[model samples]
Target: MKKILFIDRDGTLIQEPDKEIPQVDSLEEMVFLPWVISSLNMFIKKWYKLIIVTNQDWLWTELNPRENYTNINNKMFEIFAWEGVTFSHIFECPHFESDNCKCRKPKVWILWDFLSENDIDYKNSYMVWDRDTDSEFAKNIWVWFYKVIYWDDKHNWWNILEFVAG
Candidate 1:
């Protein structure tokens, strides 16, 4: 079975700057956390295509309104491009919690979609999420789960990947 590692964007791979969820509508606020690059590459080296699945209802709406997540893709890619890092795939849920959408975390829609679109072997895939909601999504989807944490000791992506992947 082919394996894929699905990761969360904020608070996990990227440290939550400003003590809050990133309002990364623009590249000016886009910041890469320590070891994020190395951590991802390690999984890739292990034959796991890197994927990121996240929920950002705050993007399109405030006070529980779903916002357009359309801008996020380019912003994220630009950050990676500036840093020379790349990911294979990404999926997101833009609905607010009040929307109670099935596609959001703990719902498994993103994972299911990824599996169907990529023809991935579900049994061999894993997900890394920082919060329980995201983990729940991976669980509901029947994918293995890992917690993505940040350690100040992580200074670069190589070190981060070597430590996490091991």
Candidate 2:
């Protein structure tokens, strides 16, 4: 059985900018939250496969071009690879909430599709996110879930890993 740790991008591992609609318009705006690097390394050493599931609905508009997202992901992957941490896959939904897309968080189609082709230990796999939609996605996929509250003093990724993976 293979264990996986699905993580949310914005507002979970990366710091969401102070905006009503949080977005990283450029690679320069891509800043990781505290303990992200250390926690990623810890999870990698623990032999957990890492996956990033995110909803970038804002990228559907011209305010944030698609290239920005690509550049951000590329730079992020490069940075993570330099630390010996790589994502098994990065799944994102570019459709807005109104689009009623099936791949978005709370739908679980992306995960379900992956599961249909992969041998995953769903009982041992977990999803770490910062929103209710993400938790719902985990529930829809029958996997464990953990919320990463950015403002909390004790909800860092390291602590979450200890509590959830224990």
Best by lDDT: 2
Global Cα RMSD, each model? 3.7, 1.5
Residue 136 CA displacement from its true place in model 2, Å: 0.6
Full-model lDDT for every candidate = 0.66, 0.84
Q: Model 1 over residues 1-166: C-alpha lDDT tens digits?
A: 6677777887766555563554455445556666676556566667878777877765556532333234545666776656655788777777778988877777776566556766666676777766778767777767777665556354344544544455
Candidate 1: what lDDT?
0.66
For 34-79, candidate 2 gives per-residue lDDT tens digits of 7778788888888889999999886757976788788888898888
Taking all chains together, the TM-score of candidate 2 against the true structure is: 0.93
- Highest-scoring model, TM-score: 2
| Candidate 1 positional error at 110, Å | 2.8
Clashes of 2: 0
List candidate 2 stretches off by more than 4 Å: none
Worst 10 residues of 2 by lDDT: 157-166
